[model samples]
Target: MEAPPLERKLAAILAADVEGYSRLMNGDEEQTLATLTSHRTIVDALIENAHGQIFGTAGDSVLAEFPSIVHAFNSAVAIQQAMWRANQELPEDRRMNFRIGINVGDVLVKNGDIFGDGVNIAARLEGLADVGGICVSRGVRDHLRDRVDATFEDLGEHSIKNIARPLRVFRVIFDPEGDPAIDLAASPVESPETSSFVEQSLSQDRDSDDEGHRVELAFWESVQEGDDPAEYLLYLERFPNGQFVELANARLESGGTGEHDPGIELAFWETVREAGNSEMLEAYLAKYPQGQFSDLANIMLGELRGS
Candidate 1:
């Protein structure tokens, strides 16, 4: 008989770990352990209340699965808030902060345990988060975009270890009191001129006469789902002012790769300067092979790598 095929399902995974665990332990192992134990209780309760299942835990880390991505996001916010409250009265040396990351993707299920990039990405995202902060993959943000009233600041695309594609990430901004936070940076109303980007899309022929529009739509959809930087270049090459040009440029997030809006190019340079993400540097060099910042980016990348 052939072996059974492993089951797979689409779900959201939330990964979290205490920051500076080793340093905290070095200071006082007993207090650190006790505090972690106490914090887990609060985290567990909030997660359960949000309809989440805790599947894995090790030392100061937690891995949970949620059928609903929104619930995953909510529980992450709640857990962080609870942790913040727990630390308020403690001495600075005794306080503990946890970093969280959430992602929605397909995963393999076996004997009550889940495995795959879905879980892997969540774990890696945790590493990128600041202490006591939450980072979410693009998929999770998209699912919660309209349904949840919260601010998600784009951190740009990242080249995660072992992941096939560079994943786009976002940082969540939530109120500790649990009130939904509005994205103040967003304009409530859009003028017709500003909405032009939405009006133009994969229909590249400048006319979208009929058959040409359909073909472009298919390619655009593929590019969106594929998350392939090269495909984004192709999309832009075909339609410079395409509807998704900005989005495609964002996904590309580099200096030169291909022609792009001058405004977006400046933004990329500024973000590269601010974040100093090595992946961003690499992407910059790769996309904008002949970009103005190519030499500077190369120098910085070399310094980062000690090359």
Candidate 2:
């Protein structure tokens, strides 16, 4: 008998997993399984009805593929709504909620299983989603615009693991009562209260940017004084997204000499290393292929590959 040939398809992939599955299982394994069964039954029925194929399932997660992004988004919303209704009668502790992430991309299908970064990203975005909420990749978000009765909060670009590019993320907010009138083309979501949380995050970005520029300048100065490449990388971490990423990279390549200025380089490298593990790394790299400290970044690339 001949083996089955591999299948390939352009699919809108949806991945969902129970939030706090371990806690639920620890609370009551049997009951947790029961609730999972009930929830999965509803989700499975809805997906099938929407013409989606269940590519795979683990203990508390499901991966499905749909031909249309719209169908995938609608099915996800329906699942959430149904699950919400089902949980209403249950006690708070007994309620099981899920986070969902969807993306539209090409996937490899082999032996009835789907594999690739497309699927991996969906799973990661699902983790980023709020409990009982849906988050989607930019591709899916762009596709749903002006068509769905939903509001989206931009999570900005992310550097997800195992995925080559940075993905723009958006959270889908459903009213449950009904779709609210929302402007899809409006600017990204701002904090409703502009609380300290928002301010702090913004402040950090500004500070980092400023510090990064300073470090880039200092890096050249140090190179003039004969600093070591690895030592300089430490300082660069401070301003990973710093304005001098290009200059720093060029200096590293040319082996410029300077006094060791560790602070800025360290800060910059820390950020770059983190970016390598981010959902936005791919996007960042695309824009900065010959980025600052490109040589040292190899370490991060290795780490990410291992991870």
Candidate 3:
């Protein structure tokens, strides 16, 4: 006799995996295994706290289902935040970053494991998240407008693997300007930005403490000399706990290049001029308080009173 059809339901699903699990394992198998085990323990607890069920897991990937979309989104953010805190003490290479994706849709359930396009889409969305970041489908984002206390930025439509239609994706902005390694824009598929960062750091690894210190000094001096935000970001990616991490972060947040993009400033002005509303000027100031035309924007804001 043929088996009966599997149980099915609409649910919110989350998929997550270590961003550089393969490379980390290849670099140090034993240590990688231990670290993954520890991280899984933490993730499992967080999932439960959010009232989600871990339906499946692979070597380094986690699949969980939540009854509520908000719960699932909150859980993803919490997990990343917790991992960020835990990673503070770990060295650059030893630190593990996770990419998470959440979606809400119909799913097939059999023997407590969830399947179907819902799960598949969530997994694909995970591939689009930057290291230590979250990406959610339009379905998930739709429910988060007033429910979650967080920011969601539209990533526009993206073509994902195995999905015929392009998915409307949004990035869950946990910390917009905090860490470049974690805040960089994600590509449709996994981008090499984070991986290249990891590879560069790995290549600089040294067996001698003296040699490693010298290398660290060399990188630090390079960043100081260049005074480029990208160089500073690279420095932080390689040495999360380096002596200049705090300074680097401050520079990136303060527009380290010493100026805003002229194109961006011009576009902001154009937008405000076309709209001719206080709201638009307010938005301009909010995004760029010290923008090239801040004074003009403020004057416009006052002129368009109560707008």
Best of the candidates, lDDT? 1
Q: What lDDT is obtained when candidate 2 is compared to the true structure?
A: 0.69
Q: Residue 262 deviation, candidate 3, in Å? A: 54
Candidates 2 and 3 compared: the better one by lDDT is 3
Predicted candidate 3 versus true structure: per-residue lDDT over 22-68, tens digit per residue: 99999999667756754665577578767788978889999999988
- lDDT tens digits, residue span 1-307, model 1: 8765788999999999999999999999866776676577557656766778898988999999998998889889878876776676577998889999999999898877889999999999999998889999998998898887688999999999999899999998877655222211122234687677655763475454444545655566577556678888999999786545665777687533435554444445555544454565665566566554554465457656753
RMSD of every prediction: 23.0, 22.3, 20.5
Backbone clashes under 3 angstroms, per model: 4, 44, 0
- For model 1, give the 10-residue run with minimal summed lDDT: 179-188
**Candidate 3 regions with alpha-carbon error over 4 angstroms:** 2-5, 176-307
Can you tell me which runs of candidate 1 are displaced by over 4 Å?
A: 1-5, 177-307
User: Each model's TM-score?
Assistant: 0.57, 0.57, 0.57
